[model samples]
Target: MILENNDFKLDVTSEIGRLRVLLIHSPDSGLGKVVPSKAQDWLFEDIVHLDTMRTGEYDYYVKLLMYFLDPDKIKGKLADIDNPESKRAFFKPDNETFHNSGKVVEIQTLLSDILQQKDIRKKLVAAVCAIEGCTYRLQLQLIDIEPVELAKIFISGSLNDEQMIFAPIPNMIFSRDIGIAINNHMLLNKPAKKARARETLLVKYIFFNHPLFEGYRDNILEIPDTVQHFLRPGEEQEGKTTLEGGDVMMVSPQHLLIGCSERTSVSGANEAIKLLFANNVVEKVTVVKIPHKRDYMHIDTVFTQVKRNVWVLLRSLTIAEPAQDESEPIAWFADKKNKDRPEIVQFRRGKKPKTFGTLEALLDNISQKDLQSTEPTRFIYSGNDEFPFDAREQWTDSCNLLALKEGVVLGYDRNDKTVGAFQKSGFEIIKVQDLLQKFETGELNPQEMTDTLILMPSAELSRARGGFHCMSMPLMRDKVH
Candidate 1:
């Protein structure tokens, strides 16, 4: 598809807009691999059945996208490229297989070389997805081998290092966390966790090789080694520096809120802003420091903007001490006298100090009923009123909501206390199932509905430590004023 008109400007002014285009990936079998054994390692707090989750998520994308864009306007990576001929073409061999045993070494050498090249990187990544190849395989024979036997074989020089191969990436369905588009630029994230690295690879291929976005493929950005080393060192780890798009939410063209938690770090947020502003891509950002607990890893875990000056948040964290002011400081000499006289002089420093207090106090001081119109800032809440422990649980995403437009959003239908708070604040809430029915019955005009909230059930997806917004990425949004 050709973008004849550059109508979709990144300078967002509001969340409600005429839905134009969006990108989504349906949940697939990869979710099935998230078992109790590997859940924690993979950053999942709980494992869920793939079938139900996929069904629910599918309804989410289909119904949600149909509301904003032309039913045919929205696109999905898996849906667009499912043609049999296309799959055959992608997996067709470009080179002949080796006939001689020695040629195996040649093949290995070629594979290694190709893996490093930019063009071949694209091709190989495409092939991996096309072939659905697993990078690792279980060796039944090796499973029974005893430590003594393996050690003796190794000592006798009878063991080989090539026994293990590559493993398949089983988590591409959650495409939002793997790669993101900031304005017109694309940044393929290197997820700090090992289990999600394949997500980055798959996204790299789609951005580079997909015919729909071929023209802008070169806009991809990578994390610099210097920043990576500073945040996540190869040796002794002293500080945290991991960040993900799922945790970062843009409130406006100039303001961004980054969540600092177990999955993201203070340094990571700083470095990301430096890179973004240095590249002239973004002007300002607000770093919101969330607890390091596993449940509240990203900013989206607690808050999301639903409409202009409206937000649905976990009242606890948003109103707790507001995030420390992460703005850069200005340095100046207070006085230049007595340099040679050896007289005492005071040095004054100026800083954009942060407000640390209860959420009610902060809001009272700001005197702003709407959050969007306030000076670009973040708010934290005291613990939940219903249950003191709800803060930790909610921070794990008990309150996150997804905005279909400025006034519209989606959240867990059962969070009545939280939903009551939103309704009190002037939001109109609807269950996801109800909304789907509205669309089906033609009671709702998908394109005409600007700001609406469609709540999803948290009985299953929430245990995995994410809310509606965390599980989704908005490829396109209306400019928020």
Candidate 2:
């Protein structure tokens, strides 16, 4: 099969590198269908107001990304784009007025693009039908429908606004977990939960089939399940090799971090380490395993890098001492090994595994040693490291941030305590709406922006339990200088 290569480059060398291009999914109708009872099964803590997420919250994210990554699409068009009469046509992937910027790419568009091929469309329709257990008649109907509308149904599970053909993949908006970019390679995820199974299938097809990644097809890595994984007992299923992009962080060109959390298994990290070393994708890989809890789903939920010399983290899980209770001596002893404090271990090819006592120590090592920063790494605690606030803000993703460039990041506006922490760290904070206006007025330039935190509204977006980092899959970024 011949694939005509586009001008897009598949690369991401550092967390805080200047983001050149990324993949994101705007909130679709599927996000609106998450009912309370099925929320947990669907990987959402609570159902979100789809309209508000689209117009009030996620719209700004698309605009901000466009302004920074592809300014020509957004510049001098804010008022016309937001005009009520437009009915958000500018943001809809299926609409004619959609801002199909080459830099700020959309998953839905890519899905539709691949579906245009006859053989691929037939295969994907059959695959989805088999997974969803659809009737033969429904499968035929789907295959007959046009590619654009069929692609929408595949994501939203609805033929139209009123009828749902299958369960909606509501979690698709968090595109990061679909795959991750490591330096010049793309490592896809094998999702941990049944709810995200369809997402994985759809994304795998996109990355392998999309023309934009034509030249880099061989660089796409997949983590296969362990031999006889299906035979694993139910009680031991947690040990199965399940990896998600949320747990994978490309910190530097030579280093990577894999988190063992609720969404990623220990075996997954082990497999990833072996693969990266065999491929020479990186020189070192660190597996950071935190307590298996839903609140802290992945290591990104616990901490993220803001710059080469700065990081934001949840002190309770990353740095707090293990609380020992003498009443339960055995349990307390066990907790010390894996509970309160994170288990940090770094692995390199043909080298002894190195361990760190705390996340702070590991991040500092990355800043000072891996990236060679001149100054010591600085830390900002979630919720300002206060008792209830730390836990509260962490739940809302205070630590989950996406750096636009070194020292410039994007996070939820509602995390007031975390916002205060950033302010104390000598970073200027501005709301997204205000910042967009400033950009329109030429008051601030994104390229020159530094030590800044751009706050995004999260009333509806936060209910989905992810941040900008989870919502993004960076494809190309300038090497951190």
Candidate 3:
């Protein structure tokens, strides 16, 4: 599936660049096993029907991505893959019927590729077995399993459909959290929750051992813990250095954004700044200290770029309604209270740190200064800036849109008000199925698609609380000059 090439590019300078390649993991068997009691612990808002997520919702996403990034794989096989009797073999990494696309890559395929080596296979098996607390006999049995099956077992935590050996990593579907690709480099994550510990371990092995990433091995950046980490917070302690990929964003070749949120701590942001500076990864790093709340787990959940001059974001970060009425004596001071406002500061090597008053201001500066957009920047607010709907749709990942090119993005169909905002912005809105049909019928082409928002089915996928942006890790893109 890797289809290794010496020319495989790894540069990603802007989030809205034309996507060439990416890493994604489809919903595995583990996603269906999430029970209600452990849903919150496992970082899910609700238990979803995994079958629907795979067939009805996510399969369309895979098809749409293939049509855009790797069309040869899905252009002619729509009917075959859409058949229920196919049992999603095209999405499964091990099956002969798998798409095995080099562009729309499956992380499991990379894991299996590295696992085929006897020594690497043994080490990975032992590591996974130890983490899952497998019996000595079972560990030995696991080591003897074939590479493809073993990789599936490692990810799904199941030996067979009937036998679950350990907890399934339902979160692996959100591959964006595993690592991120900056310009010619990969920044691996140190996740905050124990539930994601194994996910981090597995991805680290793939990124380190997979031959496709061999050349960039030296470019991989791992944030180091504080020297006094021994005295730092334990698993239950507060404010330890943990950084998830969701919190980190490479906005431009010389500009990166790191969020200090519920999953990413201030210490994590500090280490990232120092590391990127020492490594010359960027000229400026903006630290956005958002509220440490589950409501806004990462900055990406609240905002993502739709184009060089356009951003889709929650309005709460930019708009403030005074808690006290104008008639009240302390109403003016209420604005100064800074309720829910993100603390944004930019760091450059030799320059004094710069602070931004609002999220909108920082993004406008990025559009004008970093991306060189001459037009006035625009923002499409979640839920059309409506009060309760804004919060509700933000919770459903309305702001987490993934740009295929500059103006085309993928979003959930359920975010009605947000879709309305885009429609009002003179952007064309179409369901993903219809667009895919057009692509297949030659009525539309991905290259010609502009200012369009492709709506994805979200009945089951939305329950996972991540959008396509959170589900992708872009590996290559044409830089927006």
TM, every model: 0.66, 0.95, 0.96
Which residue pairs clash within candidate 3? none
lDDT of 3: 0.89
lDDT of 1 by residue, 1-481 (tens): 1112244332222233333444444443345555577666666666777656645444454445554454433223323322433422221122122111110011112223333445644444344434434332323332234432322221121224233233323444344566556766665565667666555554565456543454666556665534346556354253545567775655545444455666666666666766776666555555555556554555566555555544445553433222233474522321111111111111112224354343223323222422335544333221233454355446545456656665666666656566666556555677766765576567876656654556676565655556656555455565543
Model 3, residue 150: distance off in Å is: 0.5
lDDT: which candidate is best? Answer: 3
Tens digit of per-residue lDDT, candidate 3, span 414-436: 99999999999999999988998
Q: Count the backbone clashes (under 3 Å) in each candidate.
A: 35, 0, 0
lDDT tens digits by residue: candidate 2, 379-418: 9999998867888899998999999889999999999999
- lDDT at 319 for candidate 3? 56
Best by TM-score: 3
Candidate with better lDDT, 1 vs 2: 2
